[model samples]
Target chain A: MNRFKNNLTPYFFIMPAVILLSIFSFLPIIVSLGISFTDMNLRGLANWSTINFIGFDNFVQLFQDKVFLKSMGNTFIYVIIGVPMAVISSFVIAYLLKLVSDWMSTTFRVIYYIPSVTNIVAIAVVWSFLYNQEYGLFNYLLSLVNLDAIPWLEDPFIAKLSLIAMAVWKSNGVSMLIFLAALQSIPKMYYEAADIDGANRWQKLFKITLPSMSFATFFVVVTTLIGWLQFFEEPFVMTNGGPLNGTNSLALFIYQEGFQYSEFGYGAAASFVLFIIIILATLLQFKLRKSEDK
Target chain B: MDLKNNFERAIVNTVLFIGGLLVSLPFVWMILSSLKNEREVLSIPPTLFPNAPTFEHYINLFTNLNFDVYLVNTLIIVFFSMVGLLLNTMAGYGFGKFQFKGKEIWFAVVLLTMMIPGQVTMIPTYLILNEAGLTNSMTGIILPGLIAAFNIFLIRQFMVTIPDDLIEAARLDGAGELYIFFKLIIPLAKPILAVQVILTFIGSWNSFLWPLIIANEERLYTLSVGLALLQDQNVSNYGLQMAGSTFMVVPVLIIFIIFQKHIVEGFNVSGIK
Candidate 1:
């Protein structure tokens, strides 16, 4: 009995958390999986009797859907552009800041991170003002250079680029600090050894710093990829996927389908597509990491 | 060589200073524009300083837009989220210190769940909440987010660092499991928990998409959702939107300032993926 009770103790401690995860995390996965194959919409959602389990119909339709295709293309663009922007810029900033004095670096880190923690709605609002056509700051600066005031959000392509620019600003802070931590962990002797060997900045950077930073690079790349694939909040607030669905992302498409248009089945299918992509990427990362360790 | 090094250092410092200014300029503009009147905000070749700082937009956020209620609503949700932190710390402690059946498998499940992005599960969660008759309630929004896998993983990592012997001593002293968790683990895990709560506070406070969907009813809206509404209400009212943004921005800024070190550390901890 005592042994049984001792064995039961950990289960008791973890029971509530498990229950919460079941209701929110684990169960939802299964439920969404089931929902994806059925025709569950605003009308059918009310009565199970009305719901149709049209096997793979929603999944089939999602492939042929024009808006879905556009959003998929847009998400690909976001991940492609946004991920490199985050990785490369943060790498450069982190490398440069590590050269500065401690106080100065910390100050800049705080400044950059301020946007990361700020409410997204607030940042979108402030950015919308800066991106405003006639009276905005960006255009105001442009006028000083005798240039035209470009429509930042009114044009489809430009709106996508604008969102990408904001994504870089909002995300780079955390990635930079992560890179800084990676930089600090590198052994100093490598740099000193390079100095003794009379290595140039470019060679030492390529040969030493870049290799050492690979771990952090891998981390930032994977996370940023996952994040950009779900890019919603910015476009939701900024463009609402406007200018002919140009800024629509996969996650945003899912949101509008499920909530706005009440196309829950379609939304679930799109979500599963994203889910599969994320899982594959993560598994690939682990596999690569294991092989690299050898 | 010395002169070149100094020159390089100076150039880097100047570049950093300028970068810092650029990073901070939008926020400065947000606050300054918040203080200006309607006409003043839209003036071409906008002045850095407000011609006449007015409280009208701020006043309108409360009186016209019903912002105070949303602010309170945000606080309530954050409070629930923070309360759930204790529950997370408890489970984390169990996973960290206790030897049990299926320990590795259970912990693996927690880690695996992190890979499942919130998007995939979002619809099912809404359905679940709707079935529970919670769709329009604040509980619907707060319940699904009560405890995240990330929080559990982070807390478990912190709890494992507390020497096992200390917990063993407590166990030997005739203390119950609950007592050990409450008295021993809780006190020692305060720093990690503080860092987590700060992150969760910002996360919960700023979360938009969840709040927007789960609580479509205006009264149940959080401040971020309310700010979005304020934006949509007057698409071109920069002054009003900026003022509303200020209220939303200020609390987060204050908390971030107070816990900047821990906040940065929290991001670092999460990056350990």
Candidate 2:
């Protein structure tokens, strides 16, 4: 009895978390997959009898969905452009930070980090003002420089670019800090050896710094790519996937279908598609890394 | 050599200084614009500084827009942060220190689920909550996120580094399991605990999508939801929007400033590993 009781102690410690995750995390994944096959809508939500197993119809319609296809295309564009921009800019900023005085580095790090901590709604509000067509900061500065006041968020193409720009700005700080930590972790002996060989700054950077931080770079790129793929909040708040659905993301599309339009089955199908894409992308990156290692 | 080094230092300093100002520009604009009257805010070739600073919009948010209620609702984040910290720490300690049947499997489950994007599970979670009659309540908003898998994993990673002799000695002393956890393990786990606290607080505070869905009623709205609704209702009211943004951002900025070291260190710990 005492041995049995002793074994039970670990379960007691872990029970609450297990219960929570079973309901919220594990169960939801299964339920979502189940729902994706059915024709669930507002009426279906109200009556279980109304929710019929519609087979692949939802997935079929989703592939035929122009807006959904556009959203998929837009998400790819975001990840493709935004991930590299964020990684490169953060790497540059982190490198520059290393060269500065400690006081300046600390102060600038805090300033750069403010956006990451600030709520997305607040960020959207501030950037919307900055992106305003008339009497806005960007256009006002443009006027001072004798340039055209380009519509930052007004044009469909520009709106996507605008959202990407804000996302990079908001997200750069955390990645910068990650890069900074990686930079700081490199041994000083490597740099000293390079200096003894009379290597220039560029050679040292490409040879020593970049190669050493490869794993950190990979981590940032993967995480950032995954994040941008699901990109929802910025476009949701700023444009509502608007100016002709140019900025719609798969995540936002799912939200619109599931919650806004009450087409739960269709949304679930779309979400599953997104989920598979994300997993595949991550696995593909790992494969690429492995091949490069060989 | 000295002159060249000084020149490089000067160039780096200038570049970083400009970058800092660019980063700060939007926030500065938000605060300054919030202080301006509507007319001044709309003026062409906008004024960098508010010529006539006013707090009317801020007053309006509290009195007319139910921001006070929103603020109270946001305190739910604090409540969940504390509860989540307790639950995750216990689970972490259990996984880190104790041997149990299927322990590796369960821990692997937690780690694998961490990679699943929250969006995939969001629809079913909402449906389940609706079935439980939790919709349009604070309970619904806080339930799904109460014990994050990532937090549990982070805490577990930290707690595994804690020495086994401490737990062995405490067990030999006839201390209860609960007593050992509350008294011995928690005190030693302060660094990770601090990291968990900041992460949970910032995450819960900034959370928008779940709260936006669950809190359909005005009084139940968190700050992010309430502010988003306000923006929707007042798209042209730049001053009012700026004031609302400022109010929402200031508390987080204050917390970030106070815990800057922990915040950076937390990212570093998560990133490198």
Candidate 3:
């Protein structure tokens, strides 16, 4: 009887979360999968009978759609460009920070993290000010050196770059903190041994520092890749996917299609595609991590 | 951690601080520019200092925009969602140490949900809420976030380390599970609870997409939604928007200041912020 009670004890503890997840998390995924295989819209949302099964029509249409393709390309560009830029910049910043006193390091960490925690909407608002074509800070800074005001948001390429720049700045703190902790953990003996060999600064960095942080590097890179791929909040706020559909990300496209356009089927299909990409990337990362572990 | 020479050290420090300055410039600009008039904000070469600094824009948000309503609505959603924190801890404690049928499978469900980027679940979640007649209701916004899989995992991480002997002792004293949970486990889990509260509050307070969808009525608007509405109404009004965003940014700043250590520690463990 006592053994029976213990078996049931875990059930009581796990029941609430499991039930909620079944409702909110598991049920939604199943429902979304169902929706993806059908032509569901606002009309269907009102009258369930209007929904009709359309096998792969949404997926087929998504692949052919120019805006969808552009958004997909844009998301790839962000992840590809963003991952390296964020990781390297943060690593460099943290390495420089290692040269400072403990208090100084802590102060800078606090300063850097402010943006990471700030609402993306709030920062995006500030970004509009900085990106403003007429009298924005970027143009103002350019004028100081007699350079013409480059259209930060108007030009597609520059617009995407500006978004990437914001993402790198916003996220670098996480990598910085992670890298800082990893940096501090490197055995003092390794550096002391390097000193005996008269290793120069660059030599020390290349030999001891970079090599030592392989796992931390992997963590930052993989996570950043996943994050940039789902990039939505920036474009949704700053550009609304753009002056000419340049900044559109897959997530934004999914949101616009689902909520704004009420193309529930299309949005679900697009999200599933995005889901597959993320899973593949995550799995690939795991495989790489495993190889590194061995 | 060794400094090579004065020159090299000086150069690295300067470059690092300059990068920091670049990162911080937009925020500094936001505050400085918030005080300026329309023309001053849109000037060709932006003024470092506002020629005539005014709180007029902020005044506009409170008076014309009914910023107070949004503030109260935001607070309500955040406070209600604290239930999620309690639920997460309870569920986490169970997963942490309890042995039961299908525990691994149940835990996998929690972890798997974390990997699913929110878009996949969003449409159906909305449909589910709509079916319940919760659409356009504040409860629609609060219900979806009442428990998060990531928060469950975080709590589990904290609870697993808690020696089983402590709870086992209570059980020996004829204490019920409720008594052990409320009287002992809760106090023990205060640090992780604080971490969860800060994270959940910040997340809920600043949440845009869900709130945007649910709060169709102007009266139900949260700060992020309100800021977006403010932008839509006056597209060219920089000062008004900046001053308005300060409403969202400042509370978070206050939280960050007080909970700096926990927030950073939380990020380190979670690999997210």
Task: Enumerate the candidates' DockQ scores in order.
Answer: 0.62, 0.66, 0.60
Question: How well does each candidate superpose onto the true structure, as a TM-score?
Answer: 0.96, 0.97, 0.95
Q: Which candidate leads the pack in DockQ? A: 2
Interface RMSD of each: 2.4, 2.1, 2.5
Q: What is the per-residue lDDT of model 1 for residues A1-294, given as tens digits with 9 covering 90 to 100? A: 766777888888787887788789888899999989988998877888888889988888988999899999999898888889888988888888889888888888888788888888899999999999988999999999999989999999999999999888888778888898888777889988998999888888899988887788888888888888889899999999998999988899999999999888879989999888777877887888789879
What is the alpha-carbon lDDT of model 2 when measured against the actual structure?
A: 0.89
What TM-score does chain B alone reach in each candidate, compared with the true chain B? Answer: 0.93, 0.95, 0.93
Model 1 over residues B1-273: C-alpha lDDT tens digits? 111488899998888888788888889999999999999999988988998889999999999888989989999988988877777887898898888878888888778777789899899899999899999898888888887888888888887789988887987888887788888888898788878888888888887777888986899999999998888989989999999998988888998998998767555444332
Question: B115 in model 1: Cα distance from truth in Å?
Answer: 1.1
Candidate 1 residues lying further than 4 Å off, grouped into runs, are: A1-8, A283-294, B1-4, B265-273
Whole-structure CA lDDT of model 3:
0.87
Q: Tell me the TM-score for chain B of model 2.
A: 0.95
1 versus 3: better lDDT goes to = 3
Please give the distance, in angstroms, between residue A192's alpha carbon in candidate 2 and its true position after superposition.
Answer: 1.7
| Candidate 2 chain A: 10-residue stretch with minimal lDDT | A1-10
